[model samples]
Target: MVKNPLKIFMLINCLGMYDWSLSAKYFLNIYVFASTIQNSGSQRHMHFIKKTLNMEIFGCFALTEVSHGSNTKAIRTTAQYDPTTQEFIINSPDFEASKFWIGNMGKNATHAVVYAQLYTQGGQCHGLHSFVVQIRDPKTLLPMPGVMVGDIGRKLGQNGLDNGFTMFHNVRIPRENLLNRTGDVTPEGVYSTSFKDVRQRFGASLGTLSTGRVSIIGMSVVNLKLALSIAIRFSATRRQFGPNDDEEIPVLEYQMQQWRLIPYLAATYVLDHFSKTLFMDLVELQLGLLQNDKSIRQAELGREIHVLASAGKPLASWTAQQGAQECREACGGHGYLAMNRLGDIRNDNDPNCTYEGDNNVLLQQTSNYLLNCITDRHQDKVRIESPLESVNFLEDFKDILGQKFMISRVEDCMDSSVSLAAYKWLVCYLLRESFQKLNQERKSGSDDFEARNNCQLYKNLWATVLQGSKVLERPSWWREFSSYKPTVGSLKSKL
Candidate 1:
């Protein structure tokens, strides 16, 4: 195993991992079913219906591989067809190509919805895709033939998961295993999928990625809240440097400490509002997608929400990580102890920057989506509408950046309004820079791969811009704050 067992146990304890396990099972069996019955049914049900449906549990989502952590196109595992038995012959081909870093994968999971390259006619397959594979006995929890599984071992945090790696030496699963909602395969060795463009098909796999990003953003907000509350309360009580030239004063009084804590406090408020707004918007998008087959609005919303989530998570997580560090430093020595919770908070939030898409790689997705809109308007004469309007700053980019947004009536530095102005300008600045870099790449004859990699740098730049804009423009979260809305009774009275 790659992870240290002891540290894993401790981290798991800190995170209430057992509680998550119970909650997951409960939701999978009950709430998730109740919610999805009218829809497509629990994804778990869709993946595993005939194979010991009640007793078995699955731990799979084709995300990370030993060699290709974020780049799905590089994954080397293959699920090729076996004509005689009508099964897919699964093979790792090599160690670096082996499946790794999957949660609940060690010995806890009996089944996995494996991701592999689909091959039919011996021609090279184009992209990564998902398939159902039974790896162990649901009752026994042991590896099956031509299969190997074990833990990845110690990390900074997140230990409850039996994150493990597996190698398939010609392991086999049925040919009917392909999850065909987006793509499919025929028994006579044929490939079929709705997506004509390979890139679009690749993108189809990431539809749920936005949901994960949104949840992580929400998690980052709560984590910030927890750390802030602890530090703020402690600072109010803990006394340090001085008052009337004699007695010690509460640490909260120190301007330096307040400076460190207050921005985080303000940030937590901003992120809280941002998360709530994104969630509501996501709900509407989800509902529309479920109700209608082709939802242009929802697709746009998904792209927008994903961009927001990707943008907010890195900002909020990096902020929370820094805030936790500050909180620890502010508390002096006691904060180092696990009991105080700041260190644990830091450890937990650290992964947020790397997982569910590494912050850098994920940022490119945001930039790509934004750039696509910008380029479309310029090249196709396509008049962009909807959420792209949020990016209107792109049109007046030079003017927006050349002058301060709210010059004359600049509010107090601490006021939320001042922060909003800074944030808006940052967004405009980054958007302009991204467009400029994109245009330059096109002009300079850079290859598609190099251009895309170059865009990653702009993504990080935009993140900083997005963070500054959040402080200066509108708080996404504020829309959801109950305090901002009219009372339900007042609305009812109008009715």
Candidate 2:
């Protein structure tokens, strides 16, 4: 177990700089499963780690079903406990229930940590549970009996990764194969859990799932940096229209080029710091969990971390998506050339916005968490207790809501502080409006899901904007801006 999880993120960032597709495959297949098993406390499967570290066995995570991506609860795959045989049977009832878009599962993986609905002897379905199931033989590279697996074919990017699919038909494994940290099934087929609340237990079980999303944040920064580096360097070198016929100006000197590329450059610095800080926070939470600290504070911290990841993934990914496209366009015909690598960067990053969790669906989680905080404060159940203080400003909701944008000049708006204040106001306003819409929907006899869906537009926008502003605040780039003036002058000198 790495004491600092951020180190993993940094390593992924470096790998992404070389090849994002390779980094994505490593993240989805190795890093995520490793983190899950470490947190899962499945001692019986610990050898999988040794094999992985020794380069003996490759692994993939299988969660997304053919018909169910974000909706884990709706997955139809079943793992039924058989007390008579002292084993668990894993099965996919239909094609729709087959696992889809599983990285590294098609061609290379020898094992998988599969998520399936658990069933005891009493015919009770106990939500989703993780199971370590052997998918292929290490030496022969063949699928096990009763398992159907194959590659998903080529993709827009990440074609190097064998994104695959799997289906199981009455595949039986030992009862000990279950990842039973939060809940377990005994030989007698009794299902037991430490937490009384199902939701809380689910939360505890998924404490480490954010690792992939956190890494995506850093990978997005890498993508942004790559795109900006190529575009900016090209802009500095490529010459165009000039004031005199005898000389041509560097593209970087054009205000349009600066406007297109500089802000994203600044954002790259901002998101880089934000991603590292978030990774550190994740490390702290994981360390506490590893120490078996089940305190309420730890649980709250986990929840906070989840919300941050849910929002941060989308924020960083969408930024990379837009930045890559912008950079591609800024470099003109040269960026379109395969030699420059901008196209691959753009295509590779597109999936980040949709994977782990769909960006829009993930935003709903953050918004729902925010709504709960506001409700808790209003009902006096608790103060705005954000362990990370990401939402502590909600405590001063009234004041924040009252604030109006006052910056009248472009110069004033350029200051980070002014931008922060304005964004805070916007977040507060959107939060209030979203809350009102949700309440109105509920008052009309809509269920929680309906109410949330009704407010999706505001909730999504609020989370996205709030996360961007938060990241913008994490880096001390103003001083760096002052120091980099000479570099800008040098680019101009090329004219």
Worst 10 residues of 2 by lDDT: 486-495
Off by over 4 Å in 1: 1-55, 122-126, 245-247, 287-292, 387-389, 392-406, 409-422, 451-459, 469-495
lDDT of 1 at 250: 91
What are the TM-scores, per candidate, against the unseen true structure? Answer: 0.80, 0.91
What candidate 2 gets wrong by more than 4 Å, as runs, is 1-4, 404-415, 469-495
lDDT per residue for candidate 1 within 284-398, as digits (tens), equals 6656645644556655666677777777777776777777788888888877887887887777778778877877666666677667877777788775556635655456545
Q: Candidate 1, 398: how far from true, in Å?
A: 6.7
Q: What overall lDDT goes with each candidate model?
A: 0.65, 0.83
The number of the candidate with the highest TM-score is 2
